[model samples]
Target: MYIPDIYKNENQEEIQNFIHENSFAILVNQTDGKLWATHIPLILDKNEAGKDILVGHVSKENPQAGSFSENAEVLAIFSGPHTYVSSSWYDHENVPTWNYLAAHIYGKVKVLNHDEAVGSLKKLVDKYEKKSKTPLRVEDLSKKTMMQACGIIAFEIEITSVEAVKKLSQNRDKKNYDNIISELENIGDLNSKQMADEMRKNK
Candidate 1:
């Protein structure tokens, strides 16, 4: 979250899009004087007051679930494509580094009631199931399936601040930047290809 001026992305719309694309987030909070973390898929949505909030759930068995409270602060991290950037790709001598995009969101946590949780679940299921051959829905689930929800705790976080960083070789000159993209594409891994594509967009 310590983003340099050159790498800091203050574009709220872009940051929101990135969060939606990389919705699987690392949720962190303090528990018993120690930090607790959970990796889960969270969706961005607005609360009844029309403010931005993130919705997600954790299993009741998860110790982190018990830590959620109305006033507790939590952090959610959304990570994007990234890969190693070898100095060999740069024309001038330099050390290897990694290029990536990430967003850190800080918010106040609040546990949601059953009805609100169901509403959130409906939205989550509808969004992800859109691309499926046979889209299923929360309303369509059987009683047994609904009972499974009892094992989890749904919550929402009112977003207080967000820090987005886009470190896509913005410091490199045109020649080195082009070469870096070329090298990444040539590497041909999924991460490399995606990073190459993002670098081009950043350029």
Candidate 2:
């Protein structure tokens, strides 16, 4: 999360959109003086007072599930596509580098009650299942199934700070940047294509 001034992106709307697009996040916290991490999908939400919140759940059996206490500090990382940029792609001599996008969110964690957990599950299902041919709705689950699902520990993080970076070769000259984009697009891989798209957007 060490973002240079040139690479830092502080646009609130853009940051929020990026989080929504890349909802899967790495949640990190410290427990018993040791670091712990979990990879999970989280939903970005807003409170009645318009404060940003992150919602997610962990299995009750997960040790991390017990780490949440009021105002516990945690970090959530939303990583986007990245690819290696060869120096050969540049018009002039240069070293190879990486082009990527990522956001780091620091927040205070809060555990949710049973009712809130149920609502969080419903929202998560709706968000991900929207594009499915036969979309699954949380309401369609049997009472027992729903109860079991809600058995997981739901939590919310109130965002305290955001640090985002878009390292899309902004330091390169226009010609070299264009070349990188062109080469990446022609690579025809998911990560390369995504890097190309991000470069184009920033360009």
Candidate 3:
């Protein structure tokens, strides 16, 4: 992430919260002398040592499942809302730019055992199912279905570092910043509204 000083976000709580809100991430690794990426939803956990850990599963049929070892290093990218910022929103002349929030997490991958893998799957199911009008719990799955799910591979990533960015026009002057926010809010799309809210919070 090529983040300018103005856009750099060093707030740990904000970064973690962003990760939690955008848990669906892109997991990237190197395999067979080539780079591979997988899109998946990860659950964040904190260890007794207060270190961040990420848990997720990969389909057995996916070749990336075998791309990692016990201590292999990998990256997970968690991206929040983003939108285009028009130069016209600025009080003075400026070029168009983008405003967004994102976190790049680097970690060491640790493959989980069969029981742990099953637990990870259950946790994911429970998290998303709660939003349903009539929640369907993972435990409701039939024995055969559970058996079939065993084919998935589960792993944990022990977080090493985090690089986060919040490009919400912090580099602009107050008048321009306010203008940008107002324009974004008026646009009314989800991404634009999100950018506007972030700008207001940061301001």
Candidate 4:
């Protein structure tokens, strides 16, 4: 991801928070000279020592999972709320831009074995089930069944590097930023208004 110096987010805590809040991410990998992508929810794990890792799995039939070997550079993009910013809202003549928050993480991935894959499944289950009224539960799949139904790929990214961007109107004057906020707030769509609210948070 191309991030300008002004828009760069170097705060590790903030970046991790963004990833947690927007766990659904686009997983990108290089295949046979082509880029392959898949959208999936990922869990961020942090140890007591503050070391961080990422965990996720794709469907068994999804070809993207097979592209990564024991050590492959992979990127996962987690996007937060964003909206279009019209140039008309700026104080001076400026190009139209987008306001948003995102994090891109690059790391090496290793395919997990069957036993390790089972733990990954449980983590996914716990995440989705935590909010259910009945708390739907999944019993561990048999080794044979898990090996069959699950493409059963689990990989951990050591987070070799991360880049985050927060493209709000930080470069603009207060008046122009306020005007943009008011305009966004007046938008009828809920998401637009939500984006506006988010923008206002940093002001």
lDDT of 1 by residue, 1-203 (tens): 68899999999999999999999999999976689889999999998899999999999998888777633899999999999999999888999999999999999988988888888899999989999999998999998889888888999999999999999999999999999999999999999999999999987
Q: What is the TM-score of each predicted model, taking all chains together? A: 0.97, 0.96, 0.95, 0.88
Name the 10 consecutive residues with the lowest summed lDDT in model 3. 62-71
48-154: candidate 4 lDDT, tens digit per residue: 46778888887767777767872288999999888988999876898998888899999878677767776777787788788888764446445565555355577
Order the candidates by lDDT, highest first.
1, 2, 3, 4
Off by over 4 Å in 4: 47-50, 140-149
Candidate lDDT scores, in order, read 0.92, 0.91, 0.88, 0.81
Cα error, residue 77 of model 4, in Å, equals 0.8
Model 2: per-residue Cα lDDT over 95-158, one tens digit each: 8999889999999998889998989999999999999999998889898887697559998999
lDDT of 3 at 32: 66
Report clashes for each candidate as comma-separated counts: 0, 0, 0, 1
Q: Residue 200 in candidate 3 has what lDDT? A: 90
> Model 3, residue 69: what's the lDDT?
70
Q: List the residue pairs that clash in candidate 1.
A: none
Cα error of candidate 3 at position 139, Å: 2.0
